[model samples]
Target: MDRHDQVLEVWREFIATGKISNEKILSPAIMNSWKRSRECGVDPYQKKVPVILKEHKLKNLLERNKDLIEICRPFIDNLYSFFRGTGFVAALADVDGYVIDVTGDKEVLEMTSRGSFVTGALWSEDVAGTNMIPIVLRENKPCQLRSTEHYCWSQHRMSGVGAPISNPAGQMLGVLVIFGPYEKANPHTLGMVVAATHAINNYFHVRRMLTESQISNKFQKTVIESIPEALIAVSNEGYIALANENARKRLSLPENITGKQIRDVIEPGNGNFLSIISSKNNIMDMEVQIIQDRKPKHYLLTCNPILDAEDNPTGKIIILIEIVRARTLVNRMIGAQAKFSFKDVAGNHPRALETISLAKRAARTLSNVLLLGESGTGKNIFAQAIHNESNRAKGPFVSINCAAIPRELIASELFGYSEGAFTGSKRGGNQGKFELSDGGTLCLDEIGEMPLDLQTTLLSVIEDKSIVRIGGREVVPVDVRIIATTNKNLKEEVKKGNFREDLYYRLNVFTIEMVPLREMKSDIALLARYFADKMSARFGDELIRIDDDVISILTNHSWPGNVRELQNVIERSISVSLTNVIAVDDLPPEIRKKPAAIERDVSLKAMERQLLLELMQSKLSKTEIARKLNVTRCTLYRKLKVYGIPYQ
Candidate 1:
């Protein structure tokens, strides 16, 4: 239908509903805004419909310039609604010319279309010519034209008025033209077009702001992706919505993590930690370690809420920064403060207790004592027990592992060193263990491995009760007790020409030897319980116990590596065992290969007697057997009588 016919059709539909009890229908004018709704849908201006029948056409021209037809629809709807009786919006060419958006009164609109009166028809001096809409648009103002004003004698039968809309920034939209059967000029009607354009200008201002907001969101996403930190954005419900590339890489997420629950991405424990974070609580600077694929990693996760314009939290922002390293745990043992007294050293075995008692007795003197033991045979413990009982217990107990130091530097390590002794050395002179340990005890661990040159220097220091700096000539007097320990036999090293026999004799003030863990089978369960409780407290885990089968397995092992190996096994068991009770399955593979528990129970003396008898049966001379036993002939006979082995 043409513009006039469609107006009549909507009129019939509205009248047919007949409930018509609403307020008197509004008169046709620009502010009705009927055309506004269709801008998002179809276009009707330069394409769909006419202009005088529309409102806000000028506003559409400036901001909606890309889709003029669609933009004019709503403005046209507004104008058609202004007057109830048949009406149409028309776009005029120049004063003598065509029409653009025309509606209402079917027969009237079609005649207007066929008559070359709108849209493509010229509405300015350069075209079909002399129309108010184009001329006013050219002049940047509002104007009116009646049928008589038409410059062409043949086109004098139409009348319309048009106004141009301006933006907040004061730029022209397009010309809005309204027309109907030629009527006497109503100046008030023209005022309505001007008023409608102002409304349109306000709409453009609002749209510009919305467009700016979209641009800002784009910039925010760019910034998040570019920053170094892994940023995770979550909703109030704890669901992931945005995770940047860094976060995805750090967390090792395979797919887009958006919409995943927070529980699924971080460590299992970290989910609980996040709950606490959302609760607004924190354990600041606490080290949180995460182990992934057997490699330990650390991260510091800090959380805060995302706020809205209202200053209320809408969600949370979790920022993850990788921790380079937590501080490496220092070797914390009882020796640090000499807290172990003889009372804590348990050994019901007669020889063991006798050795402990002898150590206590020896602690009271200024003797240079040596301890022999395999690693983790409680050698350090015995050393601490002696230091605590000693008269010099109030002083620091300095410990240095001679074998652990490089061969080239063991001498300087034990003696004082002057400034500039070597590159990367301390700026000023450094006091060695001997000087630092004055009035205290100095423990030389793995002492048998000390270089021959360092041994000579140490031998002189002990004999003269003084030490010289590595780079200085002056000798310094010092007072200290020495506790040297090693797993190697000094006699074997002497025979091998690797140790000084004279120095060993000079330092053999008192000797204590620790039994290896396997030989002390009676104490395995006791020590296991002790370590379990202590480790539980240290790691904040539940205390674990060894099953009867595991204890049985422990007793059967050869334990050639001694107590140090025992500790390692127990630590590995604790790490791999998920239950509170450790079973034999948790033991190392070597332990599984050992003989039955009862098969390994022979006493040390009994085993020694058996070995000696076997050697005697070979008719080996007393000296040869004694050498094999690491003792002299006299000691061997005394041991043979003690074991009641008659050597006929």
Candidate 2:
């Protein structure tokens, strides 16, 4: 028979009835299926595809398994204990129906273990016969068999409850089977079993997704369970229900974690969000990055409501992902944490260093800070880093650029109006930046660009931290530290009567002026290396360094637009340069000078000596040059070198 006849025979073997040819046929590289059969490979079809997103960086994923397992033994015990003393036996079976753990009365356990039905037993569809454990494992659905439904005739006297176990990818982990007398079984018991199964799935999946892994039964059995961030799954009533590996280890959670309240885990000193968490269930998400009393860490939390079939919220599921690194702004750059820190400020400029020092000191206090710099000097970077270091670092850091914002909507955007405050005010009477930064820092960039009337309203916020929405009735008290930045000289604007002097004074309690790239040429090389590294990671290119001419042009050229101009040039150079090294000829037009001419006289004699010398020598670092020429480092490093002169 041809390939088509063989495929039809194989599929027909399953139904043993009507012809149901597939609409298409093909095989794949890694995995193939009945749908496509052109090539052959392993089959990995599944019911659902898991969502992939960012995960919290683990502190020590290596040691977590060991420490976490001991922590989880108690919680694991509770799951088995649910069926304990109920005369029912609970057994965890792998996807192949190989029982890993069998718990209950010893006699009942022994009774079920007989007939090749215990650990290592394979009762999958292709195995001994139809079995509840393997059925649930195959289907990923909850199932129960009443009297006479079981395949084995001898097992008719007992009923079985089984639920499928799943990994983070919605793949099967195993099956949880509760085998007991049929008479004692109730819908609540089945419901509880289903709930427990779902709870386990949620806990492992959330942790796995956050940690970016395929959390398996192996992780459960092995992980010493050293999860760093304190984790809890609450039921909206502020009741603490479930704690994952880290939370269990850190908090020493017991088997009775399901019925406990939030207060049970936190002593008064530990948790600051206790009041807010208890007041209501829904919070979009909360993140707190702290540097004091501990190393820098970003702790993120999201709360989702769990609903029943009727769509009524019965509880809340919370997951936590934390990132810790003082100099890594990987998350902040992508707005994962919505704030900047020292990690986000990557520069080596003398003035930038000075500004960073001042910002750090000012962050220690609650005073406002004014940052002055060109547009691309990364004022937002400084503002966010300051906020991240400040006392309110544990709260949100909200930013608004006055220059980019529309004039008429500035009021609504900053002070958030009610739903009907204006023609298109958000229906919910949205919370403004003030409300968003209630307990944190609010960075107002280009403060000098704010309109006159808005400046008056902003001055009120500085006087008394409060905001009145455009169409709202009452004043909302806001607790926030303000950080303002302006690329334009605020003094010039104030002189021109464009900016309010009162607001300027309020914001300029402490000031940091960012020197443009051209003025601070010292940091050019380091910034080049940094940008090269960043771009390489982004573009997957090995653009390691620039050539001598490229570096010389970079140093000699006047960057009218400052650091921003250099970045644009670098981007263009990388895209255009085909050579391994960058040449002055390849640099943007402004960098290179016209080649010097010696009157174009038939200068073959001079040119001959130049060509011969160039072939024999290469430029060196100042120290190297000094060593070669027997001159002082000072002499070799002068402007003569900048002009590419061959001085020996």
Please list the C-alpha lDDT of all candidates, in the order they appear.
0.64, 0.62
Model 2 agreement with the true structure over 1-648: per-residue lDDT tens digits: 754344444444423432334424312210122222112211112111121112231222213333333333344467666767666776666554554555677777676656445544444443333346755765578876653344334444567777776766877767777767767766666666687677777777777776755455447534434444455767767787667776554344565676778676543444655554554556543543323234333345556777889998777766555423211232244352444578756667667787778879988987899998887877778788888787777777778888888998888879877657767654445657776677777889888889999999999987988887788776667787888998888888999999899888998899888777888777776676677667655655555468765676687776777777777777666544433345455566666553553223444334534543553266645566456544344433332333355556
In model 1, how large is the Cα lDDT of residue 441? Answer: 80
Of candidate 1, the 10-residue stretch with the lowest lDDT total is 325-334
RMSD, one per candidate, in order:
26.6, 19.9
TM-score for each predicted model, relative to the true structure: 0.40, 0.45
Compose the digit string of candidate 1's lDDT tens values, residues 1-648.
Answer: 544333434434433452223223423221121222122222212322232323455434323344433555676667667743545454423222334445555676676666555454444444333445545765677776665343333344556777776655777656667765564445566777776665666677777788788989999999999977678888788889898898878766656678888777765545545655567542333323454444455555667788899988778887766642111111123233566788867656666777888898888877878898887787777887788899888776878988788888777768967656777666435557787677678888888989887788888888888998877665677787889898999889999999999888876778888888777788777766666666656655557778787777787777887766777788766554434556665566677543465344554335656787798789788888877866545556655665577866
Best by TM-score: 2
Off by over 4 Å in 2: 1-340, 343-350, 594-648
Best by lDDT: 1
